[model samples]
Target chain A: MIAPLVIFDLLLALTIVALAVAVLCLRDLFAMIVVFIIFGLVSALAWVRLSAPDVALAEAAIGTGVTGALLLKTLHHLRYVTGRLGQNAARGLTAMAPVPVAVLLANAAFCGLITLGLAVAFLGAPAAGPGFEGLVAQAMPQSGVEHSVTAVLLNFRAYDTLMEVVVLLAAVIAVWQIERGLSEAPAPVMGVVWQGFARLALPVIVVVGTYLLWVGAEAPGGAFQGGAMLAAVGLLLLLTRAYVPQPGHRGLARGAFVLGTAAFCAGGPSGGQRGPRGL
Target chain B: MLEGFGAILIAMGAVFFVAGTVGLLRFPDIFCRLHALTKADGLGLALIALGVALLAGTAGAAFRVALVWFFVAIASATCSHLIARYARHGAGGVP
Candidate 1:
């Protein structure tokens, strides 16, 4: 008899593949976004099953939650713009034209070849060998964190992490620049139920995010997951129009965006001075 | 004994989820579908969370599981309300 765990894994893999196919085949933009979100959630479950809770957290928060919200917002905007462009254009945009047969065939063949190559490579890979785990273990005493993942990310690879924060800051700036040119009408005020829900949930989310950041020194939680959770808070506020940033708070918002990079840069040099760490 | 009880609760939760999915697909209107889906899912998640909380080894873990249920319940309730309101009053409002 097949092990229950093995059956679960098989089912999860099948669900992921089926969701991928549904995402691609769905012509309705809204349905496609929903399928994509479901695909992300399933992939997050797969990550958890692989015993990578950190990746699972990141996948669920950033991959599914935030990305799904962004996609829905974009779809709402797209529909509004298309409606103004006339009924025929709206219909054309909503129901995407079918792809050419040759293009479809070529794309399918390319994807199939890539999939086959990856499967072969994965299957033919050698058994696990002695890796850097030993070295990391040896250096763990001096890494200043109980969690090996945290040590590696914030200490051993501090410069890399610092660069990642800087890149994120740059991306935020670019988005702000693009958005500044567009005149956004104020979002409608949400109903009492939504406002009440947000009020009750926001503090819980904030506490959870902070808990994740604090627990990162000893567990499968860290800055990425915490930051993603905080971003979700912002997204929620935007969605509900519960807390719009006034002009007076623009500087504060900008400062908050830069704070991560600033803190990383300040700590990176001092971290290097403390001791040599493993990669 | 606790594990067996937890398992039973989880199985019941799964049944609720399956029922919710069926109702979502089969219901003729958006309001009816949302009504079926949200109520079933909320109850399903609550049962599963309660079961898992009972199975958890520590009080902290159990509390966290309860917290998860809390957030999900609030989210689903808010979402169902919003969607229903929009369907009733927004553009292309349903009759």
Candidate 2:
């Protein structure tokens, strides 16, 4: 019953704790980035266990997906810099840090925080939100969606969703403008197999994205979910340089980004007053 | 029964992650270590996420967990590709 689920959750939490340790302890920058991606996935799982689907979706999409891409790109650029600057300096710096002492301090701090947090959560629970609960429960029965979290998000707190869209739009705009001055694009030097695999995978991702969007109204998926899927396609193309921006492509990308931002700005505040008819 | 299976998968995933970490630390070279991190780590995470998704009572919860798996797959593969590209360009080594 709930006992086993509790154990599963505990195990997941422990695994994540260990994974985070692994992420921090790895010395190689590439290995470190890989560990980070794993940590993001595990944490998203933890969010799911805690009953927050929207948060999980956001964590997976932005946290792992976009953020990981950014890190990987940065790592590549940094490695180039490090390589040209000479590995001797990097190795010397790494050797200077007393590894054992660092680990000991980090472990002590981590364990202390976890123990304190668990103790607080275990004893004397916080007060429940009566009004929010009423709103969630009331809106749950009437909303077309079956999932309570979905109803709460799409109905009760749609404003948040709107705001997220706005933020995302803003981010894309900022990145687009920053890259506008660059005359040359970075080309991906992947082998032929990667090219073929990406070609094969693109259609599948497109289908999955469409399916997620269509099912989102009733299930856990949605436009954000679908867009992430589409973004993955774009990301893959970007990675492979297959979809690298030509003159026309750059303009289209900028326009599409602006459209998304405008949509988000208009849609977000509109939904705030829709649910309970209150400020 | 489902939950039991999930527990097993989760354990297996953790083991794979540990193995990947060890491989990354001990391997003689970057390419081999990347192999361990990419294949084993991706499979490990997908398994663990799948297990959690199976245990979810509601569709929304399951979808969310599954989304994490998908993201991990996307992020890890993409990042690994970039890392490999960087390394092949002679970014790091004793030389």
Best TM-score among the predictions, by candidate number: 1
- DockQ (CA atoms), all models: 0.44, 0.11
- Top candidate by DockQ: 1
Q: State the lDDT of candidate 1 residue by residue for A51-80, as single tens digits.
A: 989889889987888788888877766666
Q: After superposition, which runs of candidate 2 have C-alpha atoms over 4 Å from their true positions?
A: A1-7, A21-27, A81-133, A141-144, A183-186, A264-279, B1-95
Model 2, range B6-90, lDDT digits (tens) per residue? Answer: 8999999999999999999989998999998998899899889988887887899898788667755875786687568778764
lDDT of 2 by residue, A1-279 (tens): 578988998899999999988987877766777788988888999988887776787678767876687788665554443353246434422433456988989999999999999999868576663646666777676776766655665556676776665566566666666655542534546565467668868887889777765576676766665677677777776777775557766676556665655654565322211110000
Can you give the lDDT of residue A256 in candidate 2?
60
C-alpha lDDT (0 to 100) for residue B43 of candidate 1: 86
Tens digits of lDDT, candidate 1, B6-75 = 9899989999999999999999999999989998998899889988988897999998898788888888
What global local distance difference test value does model 2 have? 0.69
Worst 10 residues of 1 chain A by lDDT: A270-279
For each candidate in turn, the interface RMSD (Å) is 5.0, 6.6
